[model samples]
Target: MTDPLVLGPLLRHVGETTASVWVQTGGTATVTVRSGERSWSARTFVVEGFHFALVLVDGLTAGESYEYIVEIDGAQVWPPAECEYPAPRITTLVKDRPTRLAFGSCRTSVPHDAEHHGSHGVDALRTYAMALADGEVEWPDAIAFLGDQVYADETSEEMREFIGTRRSLDEPPGEELKDFTEYAHLYALAWSEPANRWLLSTLPSSMIFDDHDIRDDWNTSWTWHEEINETQWWHERLVGGLTAYWVYQHIGNLDHDALAADEIWSLLAAGAGDSEVDLTAPLRDLVERNDRHPEVYRWSYTLELGDCRLVVLDSRAARVLEPEARHMLDPAELEWLAEQLTGDVDHLFVGTSLPFLLPPGLHDLEAINEVLAAGRFGGLPAKGAERVRQIIDLEHWAAFQSGFQEVFELVMEVARGTKGDPPATVTFLSGDVHNSYVAEVIDAEQHGAGSRIVQAVCSPIRNPMPKGLRVAMSGFSRSLVRPMRWVASRSRRIPDPAYPWRVTHGPWFDNNLAVVEVRGDGLHLSWYAGEVVDDDHDHPRLREVSTVDV
Candidate 1:
């Protein structure tokens, strides 16, 4: 066996009574995983040039921590001699508990220093998260990675150098990840750190892909697709992007129930499935079709963790982009989401890559951009609108007005108790915009229980907004957006008790990590960001930016 590329060793709830441990490694080796005296072993095989395995040990209780090890290739490969690349031992998931969840997304793997990190600002968020995972602090039950788990479009200088080292950057698609091998290596680089990899193995993670995971403005519009197809390398680019995405990210996010119920899964179960499920060919076809017809096979899934129900929606890929009746969630997906939102759970957490709610001014800006694309404001040439969309990432929820409206209505209905008693809270967790903030829809007339609704926006676990753009976003939200919002509210309001005014819980402009804890009835949320104290890189301190009890 060659050097093992171990992944996960995660604990996930299989049923109300059973739990499973998931792992993916590099070579064919006997992997012995132990929770105490009892142990289970599985033989991991390298298929499609990637090592993978799943071991299910039943009869484990929820909310209990179990310590385990991985022995591969006749050696204890976990808990490495040096805490460097390729992570250490695995731990059990935070099974079945009303617990704390740490979630934020849009991380780029730049260095931690300010000037040395190649223009992406200091990776304070990564450093802080790594510190917490390395036992500098307590670990959260689960970490929800909202989106941009990787940026396929924007490659840092270090990444370019690494890719250029092995692969020819002068090829068809250049350094922007033209194939699956590049994507695999990118994931390795992203998760190779001992602390971060161990953190993922221990904490149960749920994720959804965003535009950057594929390419910038992946599905901004049909016109964008047409223009991309016009490029010589786009065929390979799309195939590689979607194929690697399915293998590296999407496959793990599914539960047994979801997998069994999926069309592709059913085919695999029948043994009539085209290539083996783990191989590259099947993934290539499904992902290719997914990119070609974004709405054909839905990538969305739901998780019922005790009393908490997490509905992670696929805002991208499955978009219904017809102008007459558009939506982010197609009718079928909307129905499925509405069914899940019966609010039988204590807290309803909706995870999507893009926030359903954006700053009203930004929302208006999107509408204007759309209108301009239709040639109202002398839009770009024929493919001008598509080009502009790619430049500014115009494929957000704001762009898909109908789908955004549907999800918003669904959330509002759930919050208002359409099925059972209203949930203690209905929180939308999102990360896409490089900045993070908590915005609450409030009834200005009264505060407290009569509040409209709460939406928490956390983003860029590592990436920080550019300085000038951050300043502009702040200025627009404060100066221009505030007054214009008031005037617009006179005509366009979200009905009585649903006053659309937004009160930000905190300020922005910091690379940060956020945690949300549900204790008793109220939900306590806190934001933490790292502050550099010295050039020696030892005195990094994590200070609380803001706290709110909603």
Candidate 2:
């Protein structure tokens, strides 16, 4: 019999005593996850013509592992017909054990064939999956997909074909995702790859969206927003992206209690037994509401991993772009984040889609652009600066000087033990730029801050920058450092960063995944890339690119 299941039996939000399993079904049906003699089931909730269920499997033993199978409407559909890999397992977190996490961003869902490999590079997550299957590395406690898991604007050939079947490609937003249906298709393309799917099933994963998840340079500035709002297609794109995100990614990130507390989720889950309750109207309205008032909902959340704390922030949304207050995060989000930054953990990790500390060279350039766009020169030049900012991707944490200063001061306070006992390592985990690296923070006054503050960036788990662009980036990181800093010094408004930083390990431009282990009082970081052995284009072996113990 054909499987009624769709994208996942994805393991999400595993804890010491519980785990959540999320899935999409073909129709209105009950989805059950069974392991040994115990089983848990949830009736699918329908939304945007799709059925999904996030089952909270309780009574799980701490620090123990269990293999599970999925059944839909009482028929075994998962571990689909002669599966070769190990059965999907959930390994709950131990009380004092440090969390091992794998993270990366910017993957495009293209075919994994030779031609695609030539264009996109080897898929790092796929290579990691194959390596784990062969027992080459330890499995991470979780994987944080920082952003760009699906590129709605830069549609792949497969996505375009699927889009064409239901909607004309010659429309206003040609080759771009049109509505909730198309966004659903895009998620399927991203997650349904055999090896990657198996990996996600066995490994608990969380995600946050970045610009490309909706459109290029999403919410970059007031100018960008005003321009896009005038377009015929922007509203649909925003609605589709946020709606699909809520159903597919955001809901799964919550724990049992958190999920139950969610307004839309609780409302939809109430209709579970009724079988695929049409959620089209509510979902559309919710997305529209969020677009107009981002402060009403937050996509950011946190998890406590033994002695380490992980805070995954929503950097793309919850932004304030008005001329009087340009911020990467709105006041509400900032206040919430301020409260979360208090420390009593061994290591504190902030997972954001955009890096907190960009390379010094790149950081200075963005700072200069912020002042230019804020009318430092004149109206005409400010207009030009806004256009240039979008063209060059200058919208980063450093671009909002006031917001950057405030957050920098907050982090500095945490490092100095103002909130509580300072953590040994204050780390920022991020990805967006096509390259990867580590940068260590330095206090200007030479004060002993008592924490190893650093940035660990990993990007492009699949997509690689084109050669010319790679060359330009490399030149910027090296040749333009001094010149950029010199330019930034002219603007009194762009003050020196709270703490200047320098790249320590890499600027490697490889399709890569970075694994970080919270080992005692420090972080053990490693970056791995895929190397094709013996011209085997289909299978790439994991190769260690760099390792840093901080």
| Candidate achieving the largest TM-score | 2
Q: Model 2 — which ten-residue stretch has the worst lDDT?
A: 442-451
Collision pairs in model 1: 63-95, 327-403, 328-403
Candidate 1 per-residue lDDT, tens place, 54-165, comes to 5545555544556666666456666557644334333333334565777788888655565744466545555655567556656666677888888877786777987888
| lDDT winner | 2
lDDT of 2 by residue, 82-165 (tens): 886788998999868877999999999988878888888899999999899888999899999999999999998889999889
For model 1, the run of ten residues with the poorest summed lDDT: 490-499
For model 2, which pairs clash?
none
In model 2, where do residues sit more than 4 Å from their true spots?
443-445
TM-score of each: 0.87, 0.97
Q: What is the C-alpha lDDT of each candidate?
A: 0.66, 0.87
Q: Which RMSD values do the candidates have, in order?
A: 4.1, 1.5
